[model samples]
Target: MIRIRKAETADAESLALIGEQTFRETFGAFNTKKDMDEYCTKNFGTRIQQNEIADKNKCTLFCESDNRIAGYVQINLNAAFGAVADTSQAEIQRFYIVKNLHGKGAAQALMNAALDTVRRLNIKHVWLGVWEKNLRAIAFYKKFGFEQIGEHVFLLGSDPQRDIILHKTF
Candidate 1:
């Protein structure tokens, strides 16, 4: 069974590993392998994930199975989703499931946990951004009732791509 829980500092390294593996598996098709490697190594390093875990405003959720982290989601209540009442709004900055566990409902489980937390806090809305070329992720977001709110240029590797912002109203 997959268990979802708030991430603690102890989970940082595992979360980082999951981030790197998931990022590579998810975006490898849209970017060169070298670019993916550099981006993941720089952005999802243990220190970064650890810092996020240490931040009180930042909420990180981990999906564990057999005591090992399989995937995770990171959210920022103050930054991404716009300011509002307690739990009324939150920005889902990052959501990822390990590549090998993609179809096993890990992502959905993690998302449900995040949204449940939002609802518990009386949040009325949630939002996230997805690369335009990541059709799979876009569809996944849509499945959770997120709609495209807008588009913007995203610098990935040496090239620029469009990112579609999506949001859901609870």
Candidate 2:
């Protein structure tokens, strides 16, 4: 059985580890090793995880199976993206499942929790950005009724790549 719960302050290190592992496994092949290293270090560092755990309004939900964290989702209200304000929407900043648990429904469970939280918050919609090359993730989001809204270019240091901005009405 999998249990989904809000992440606690003590989960920062575990979250960082999962973030690093997931990023390296998923994006390592697409970008140069150096670029991937920099991206992971900056995004999944201890400090970032600490900050995330400290935010009460921005929820970080974890999926635990067999007493181990199998996946997590980070959601926020009043999201800011490149100067655009989405007051009535919640944004999924991150969602990841450990490689071993990919097809076992853990990801979907986590997503459902985040979506439910968004609805409870009375947000009209939920938005997220996925790398264009992450076909599996794009398909998963599509299955959840998220439609592509626009193209985004995320610059990781000097490397820039396109991402698809997807949204679903609550």
Q: What is the lDDT of residue 67 in candidate 1?
A: 78
TM-score of 1: 0.88
lDDT of 2 by residue, 16-99 (tens): 998888777777777888888788888887779989889875889999999998888989776845423556877898898888
For each candidate, the alpha-carbon lDDT, in order, equals 0.81, 0.85
lDDT tens digits by residue: candidate 1, 1-170: 89999988988888888888877777788788777777787778889988989997789998887778888888887654333333456788888887778788888899999999877877677877788878889999899898987776766666688888888888
Regions of candidate 2 where Cα sits further than 4 Å from its true position: 80-86
Model 2 poorest ten-residue lDDT run: 78-87
Clashing pairs in 1: 81-91, 87-123
Error of 1 at 53 (Å): 0.6
Give residue 94's error in model 2 in angstroms: 0.6
